[model samples]
Target: MNQPVSGFSKKSKAEKIEWLAENYLQNNLRSVQVLKNYWNDDPSLQQLHDDFIENTLSNYYLPFGIAPNFLINEKLYALPMVTEESSVVAAASNAAKFWLERGGFKAEVISTEKNGQIHFNFFGSEKVIEAFFEEIKPKLHSSIQAIEKNMKARGGGLLALSLVDKSHILEGYFHIHATFETLDAMGANFINTCLEQMAHTFEEEARNFEAFQKKVTYPEVVMSILSNYVPECLVRAEVSCNVEELTTKHHEGKHFAEKFVRAIEIAKTETRRAVTHNKGIMNGVDAVVLATGNDFRAVEAGVHAYAARNSYYSSLTHAKIEDDVFTFWIELPLAVGTVGGLTSLHPLTKLAFEILQKPDAKELMQILAVAGLAQNFAAIRSLVTTGIQKGHMKMHLMNILNQLHATEAEKEKAMEHFMKNTISHSAVVDFLGKLRL
Candidate 1:
């Protein structure tokens, strides 16, 4: 049994690795070597990564890929995506190409307001509390003026502050809901700072208010924080063409369009299908989100919540065919930043922004929505025509070969053989065995 190490974070990188190897890895030399092998060759770059977080052992890596020929709003873009999954970039690239001849993707920012809350409990009279909130609302806004000075100078800052009474849900519960425009930054730290300042000011004012002094219990602040759910921060992306233009060598255009519409309908009506269907959309959305150093986890949480906003989980993408016209679109609530957090600090993230032509926050939102729509278009096209497994398994072939420890010559032969044969783990193993024999 291993004991909990004391002051583990205080140890140097070498000492921490040695301790981990001894206690957790049974002092395996190869395992220790594996950790060191991933360290950056450049010392300054390695130090930069180490300073990003505590307990830094080694840098984890994912492939940084680009999907070219994305035409959004009549502008061309090559999207940068970072992911570990195979075929995601390929699928996005294929989708982009397919749409290029059909007017590509059209995307626009619907809104750009983010929000935070100062939650508190007031055990006093409802009327008194409401009156107090109305009186102190302006004061709360003034409290955060200095904190939001820079953001305001850039045409973004606090938009509104309102009091929400949730005493019906929980006794004595209320919140100060605040909306903001954060411009080109993700603004987590900025929003949070403003919320805390307002919360402090709110509590302080409540203490001095005559009505609150008359009450036995004063207003108590439970917490102050920014919300990941930004339904107001939204973007819409779509692609459309004549229904007959969807034709490919494998399937007729009319048949493909109807089948694609049916597939989206199934996803909307069924929860299980909706989960996987939306996950496919995220495979594209999250890859771009990660590459640009935005918060994928926040985007994921907010997106799923938006899907269920109608009280049931449903597909994020929609399709329609009417009067010989076929249109597909997705409206996503994405709050992404282009100027703050890891966006500026991470070397690859800076390069990703450059690759994207340095879009502002609104433009980034548009790009993210387009990526999701393109991804879903590719996935549904594959599913409705040749089936998903054929293309997915083909992309997964390299990983299988590496797992089998196939030589360069063996891998080439295996790729050729699988091109005309069904691909499965067992089938690959058998083919490799036969080749070796």
Candidate 2:
């Protein structure tokens, strides 16, 4: 029965909320109250959040936490994380502590290249189009001089340009592919702007080309945009220690290392296992990506694409035991930036950067890779040892308790009881029911 309302964006916040409440929320007063309750108290701060997007509603908050004692490349750091998952921060902190004594984590940036494309339709001879592209390639670079000036001054700019003919895949399809170095910024806007300019110039030049005029065919631009699949922007992070040093109370070092390597191999070979295995890695990767105000969705897309680059999806993390040493590492594409987008606008994001010691884009990529590696190590370590449920459910207990509306005394008792007993939603409910009785 809800009807679309025009000019919703121009409406005041209160008006928008009222319309939404009436049209969709069934006029629930409690729902309306809930929306207002989450609004920031500080007027300036609320406005800042409001300006972030259109039709601002109440803020949705995630817990911002710190995983301390991360030693990457001989430098100590405490990573900032934002996630609703109860076990993520606990798992990351545990992994950081475990690796701290194992010579810490080592990370390095392998490359920093991003690219975009200008898709156009060229219904003409391929040879003529090729010749025209070669002649105009230099002009394509020069067309973006004004746009690339600032980026070039910072030691990053257009890297290369090429003509790609995909008429075989889709008839009359061709594109101008361009590569770039965005430096410290995520460079999405910069790259996109440059692409738009080049696209404009490309279409303009096509009209005057002798071949196009003679053949009565023109290259019609479809779109110009940057690609999120940045495989060339990669980082590798790893941790290694003697096999004997992996010994814990539950398992011997040799057995544990062998089992760990086998688990990773299973993930690599099996798609079902690989999906969940990679998801655990993202639990860590996404937390830091969100905390630092980078686009987690973009990072996720690019990373998953990389995992499937070999024609099959596999684990992002790898493990090996050689010469009495167990090494665990992950190499993935992370096209994140430290100086632009929400990184500067969001207060918590800014704080996250400060917590990370203000790393540049490359350094941030290393940190993100290390976070994913640490998370995977922790998850696989648990899966091969205590079983994932034991620690994960224990961490999830607080959420269940909060859901059941347990009081302070009840929560304290529940924690102690679950520490000794297995945890499940029904079990927690039963325990609280008995305690209340």
Instruction: For residues 120-194, write the lDDT of model 1, one tens digit per residue.
Output: 998778899899999999999999989999999999999999989999999999998999999898989999999
- Provide backbone clash counts, one per model: 0, 0
- The list of candidate 1 runs beyond 4 A from truth reads none
Task: For each candidate in the order shown, give its overall lDDT on alpha carbons.
Answer: 0.94, 0.94
Clash list (residue pairs), candidate 2: none
Off by over 4 Å in 2: none
Per-residue lDDT, model 2, residue 80, is: 98
User: To one decimal, what is the Cα RMSD in angstroms of model 2 from the true structure?
Assistant: 0.8
